[model samples]
Target: MAVRKIEHVGVMVSNMEASIAFYRDVLGLELQGTIGHPDEAIKLAFMGAPGANETQVELVEGYNGGLPAEGKVHHIAFTVDDLESEIARIEKLGVTFIDPAITTLPNGARYRFFYGPDGEWLELFEPPAK
Candidate 1:
């Protein structure tokens, strides 16, 4: 079977409100929806990009469960144009960047990595102009 696109990334947060604010306000993600899984005693919040994109970030909270890992899964990256502005905006929200903007690879593709509320890593990629 051919592998399809990723539906979403699940992240567990101790506080759902903070997670929502950080993602919605800082990252500019829209809170598509949220649901209460009574059976599991967990709440799931789905967020999507502002413009055009189906990829989503699922915030799992109130479970008091185990954490996956910090930087172990590495990070989930998304394409962005203004890395500087994005970084500044997120930093103002108290988010920390693991590594500031760095240019690597022979092609000199610009990219940066950062951490969210629960230390979930994320990468922002800015591709070379075509």
Candidate 2:
């Protein structure tokens, strides 16, 4: 009953540094910080936009990296202003696209899927302009 919005989405990564780079450099998220879990075997990294606290992305390392048949988390989608340009830019950075082409919804929203450092699916979503 207290849930208002998604606080964060946790993703498992094999290599924490690589995952951090992909999310920070490629996706442009700022590294909030990193901490070692109480268990000591697990390490975690938190990232989000520069000034916005909205939804944060948590990268978990030393967890089960062996994702199911689907993928790490099906895919973590980030909202973008210009889907086309963002796709092109990410593609230029050598990220492979899972979607053959951008998909447009009935409401005019557009989205595309790409891969993350750990073969995890990632998406860029563009909502219809108001």
Candidate 3:
């Protein structure tokens, strides 16, 4: 009950540059910053939509990137303004889609699955408009 909200989701990545580009350029998330772990030799990067008090995406590098067949994190979903436009844009960027088509929820929300640069499952969710 004391938890305010989901702060961030950390994703393990092999190549920081590629992963950063995918999340920032392809996914439209602004790169807040990147730094080398002081205690460890790992690298860390944080990104999120500007001015949006939403869950942040943290990309971890130099850690264990040996992900399982399904990847480390099950999936991370990003709220999008336009599902159709995002799908088309992602396709144009040649990102691999895990789901063949967008799925509509009973409440009218729509979503589609796609893979990130590190094979992490990512989702684009568009809730029904008010």
Q: What is the TM-score of each predicted model, taking all chains together?
A: 0.48, 0.53, 0.51
Against the true structure, candidate 1 has what lDDT? Answer: 0.67
Per-residue lDDT over 1-130 for candidate 3, one digit per residue giving the tens place of the 0 to 100 score? 1223454577888888999999988899989866554436587787989877578887878767687855645467777778888888878989999978887754466778899998877778776678
- State the TM-score for model 1: 0.48
Instruction: Point to the candidate with the largest TM-score.
Output: 2
RMSD of each: 14.0, 13.2, 13.3
Q: Weakest 10 consecutive residues, lDDT, candidate 1?
A: 1-10
Residues 6-111 of candidate 1: C-alpha lDDT, one tens digit per residue? 4456677778899999999999999887765533567768789977466788787765456555522334666667666766777788878886456443344466
| Candidate 2 regions with alpha-carbon error over 4 angstroms | 74-130
Query: Residues 97-123, candidate 2, lDDT per residue (tens digit)?
Result: 887998775556676778899877777
Checking candidate 3 for backbone clashes, the offending pairs are none
Question: Local distance difference test, per candidate?
Answer: 0.67, 0.75, 0.75
Better of 1 and 2 by TM-score: 2
